[model samples]
Target: MNPREHIPVLLEESLALLDIGRDGIYIDGTLGLAGHAEEILKRNPRARLVGIDLDDRSIRKAQARLQPFEDRVDLYHADFKCIPELDIDFPAVRGILLDLGMSSYQLDTADRGFGHSQEGPLDMRMDDRNKLTAAKILDKYPEPKLAQLFREYGELKQAAKLARKIASVRRTQKIESTTHLRGLVEEVCHWIPQRGKIHPAAKVFQALRIEVNQELQGLGEFLIEAIGLVGPGTRLAVISFHSLEDRIVKHTLARLSRPEYGDSVIDILTKHPVVPSEDEVARNPRSRSAKLRAAVKRPHGS
Candidate 1:
């Protein structure tokens, strides 16, 4: 997929809240199409950016898209959760941005198995390096384990019933594709009704994607480690698409900025999250679900 064609949701709002510095070090933790990184680099000639993404396709596209800024950007083909371990050493990172969600390109590609509307392999690993795929989980995971995953990740009301249906169907044939799984979900979730804003398979696909990527498992640790890298005067911004991810970012930033125990080292910048304006939402409907939260590192000792 071409990088320039990718329109990142809430781009203007994100840059405004991040407050990019001219000579600062920055990290685009989820550099989907490098759309945000491109803007950050263009804003400041001296600013250096470390762009990370687990998806190889995104890395390739970003590498090509951000080529002109080679002097200031270093691309990493790794998971965002491991950013703290990357070798790039800047005295202090000016800001870090995490835009956490499957990019539109990924969903639109169809072969990536991110969207249920398309027919493709049921492989939902954002990073192809990851061993677990949605198909493997459906075929191998125990019914109880699958039920738990659906319940926790999808917040689906009928997780147990859905899990049972998947288990039974998989016994007859491998659930090898998105269409196959969608059909199975419809068979099991008859109570969801035929009419609604969202497709009935939406929750199931969402659960599988979360489980395949381990999206929530290491998020808390990742956020804690990344925030600690910000020096005084630096800011951190996170754009989350759903409540599950938003809650994680909200609580993690709050904990870092809170000043109860012996003076905190950070201050919450956005008491309320910065969401897309009505105009932006109208221009790009995808931006409607985005919620951006920001915080800044406090100077040492009050």
Candidate 2:
């Protein structure tokens, strides 16, 4: 597969919620391959983009892809959670988008260790600078800690049994490879390949990936901070791939929509989460699980 190919999930739905207008600043918090960013720029000639991503490789790719609008674009190689702290023009910003999902480029690449079916070293750090690796977690974490990680992050049913199996295996040989860990999960979960059933190894990989990157940490706080920073009418669109993230986004938006001292933070734009169309799913199978939610900030004194 060509890793360069990327299809942004719920593209039209996200753009509609953003309600892109003329001559305003926009932010792409998770600018993976500049797919959504490019679309924004392409549609609005007067708009400027501020793109951020934790992956340096992805940033470089986005840079080259967005070369046409380099003069009007600002790209940052950092996590989206830090945007609230970063020196940004908060009030003038028109829209912001956060697509929280592993890009196809990362999964398709063999060395990234994000895919379970492929054989690679167990290094699942989204930002490679992070000291934590999937191998380190497998090698260092005790059986109970491993169980907790799988149970909480992956929501796996056989977490304890799988953890016990990993603990037993690591006693003699170090769990160093993706295939090594995947095989253990399959064995412990009782190997089965049936239609419409997800593989146990996928859950194991997801748990490890979340741990390695600390993906869910501080997400709700970031949303609150961002909503408070942006001006009234600024729209925030978020596309979350898994239920855990979707739940957090949903609850946070709901909380922000309530009034405090006769002033609410945002008006919920998406009453229900928007999902991908059937044609989009057929075009990009990886986007099938995506759900998009959005809200617009309300006036402070209103």
lDDT, candidate 2, equals: 0.89
Computed on alpha carbons, the lDDT of every model, listed in order, comes to 0.83, 0.89
Q: What stretches of model 2 exceed 4 Å from their correct place?
A: 1-4, 261-264
Q: What is the Cα root-mean-square deviation between model 2 and the actual structure?
A: 1.5
Index of the highest-TM-score prediction: 2
Give candidate 1's whole-model lDDT.
0.83
Q: What lDDT score goes with residue 211 in model 2?
A: 89
- Consecutive 10-residue window with the lowest summed lDDT within model 1: 191-200
- What TM-score fits each model? 0.94, 0.97
Candidate 2 structure quality by residue, lDDT tens digits, 1-302 = 23346777898999989997646899999998988999899999999999999899989999998999999899998889999777789888999999997898888787989999999999988887889999999999999999999998898999999999989988899999889888888888888899989898888899899989988999988999888788888999999998988999999999888876245488999898999989999989888999999999887776
